[model samples]
Target: MNVTLLMAITINGFVAGQDDDTEWVKDIDALYKMTAEAGVAIMGKRTYDECVKYNAFPYKGALNIVMTHDKTLLTKSTDDVIFTDATPQGALQLLEQKGFDHALVIGGGNINGSFLKAGLINEIILDIHPMVMAKGIHLFEGDFPYQQLELMSFTKINDDLLQVKYRVKNNYENS
Candidate 1:
């Protein structure tokens, strides 16, 4: 299974503000396109909560799973949405068992860090915007070991945005 980390972050590497505000992000269509292509997206509870707060819940055309311990927040989950308390590796294993060819970690710091720490992310696709927020949640929250990546491709998404794709180098394989 291919595990890709797909995210849009500020120039300073912040995904969102302290209040879970994403007013700075401008490309909803791009995100929807990625969601459509990935078919499966895993996000932290904060990401889900922010989407719901902004009336963007139930991302269509994909199975969205919210990785959270407090599953009680959701009274129930439908086919399009589900809650799980699985670790990063466990979540990927479950998805693979279900026959998903690709899984995208659409994040809010903690989830991204967990996957990177667990060495579950194979690639990273970042759409870097022009703005920067000094005080906000970072791209990855915890301290993870240094990761090596080889750039696969890069393109200008628009006049103000650039998208970069990289293949995460497996140290064990390379060594």
Candidate 2:
């Protein structure tokens, strides 16, 4: 299955720094619209909780899978969300077995890093806002090893945002 990590970070690489009430609603609406186009959407448990707190429920028919360490959270019957303790590997394996063509990894810093560190992400679609926040959670935190990417495309979405697409470059010899 093809996996894409979708994220919106500021020019300073902070995801939550620019997040405010107004910006969050706009971001969630955009995210839901984009994820609805995909077959499946995957998110970390922390992100799921934040979504619930933010009241960003998607359409009733939309399918969502949340990765969590606690299985008890799955007991709540929700039409759109399924909880799984499946780490990155388990989640990917399940998705592969189910024959999902594409998966969108949407979230904050740690979740994005998990996918990147696991080397499971094939592509990235980053919406970079043209502002900087001096203090906030960054898109990647802690000590995760590095991977290189090749720029596939870049588009100016507006005066303040740039949409950049990148492909993970695994073969250094070709580079």
Query: Could you say which candidate leads in TM-score?
Result: 1
| Model 2 per-residue lDDT tens digits across residues 49-162 | 777886864423356878787758867636567678777878878778877778888866777888777778899888887777677767765555667889999988766668
The candidate that wins on lDDT is: 1
Every model's Cα RMSD, please? 2.2, 3.2
Model 1 scores a C-alpha lDDT of 0.87
C-alpha lDDT of all candidate models, in order? 0.87, 0.73
RMSD of 2: 3.2
Which residue pairs clash within candidate 1? none
**Residue 146 lDDT in model 2?**
65
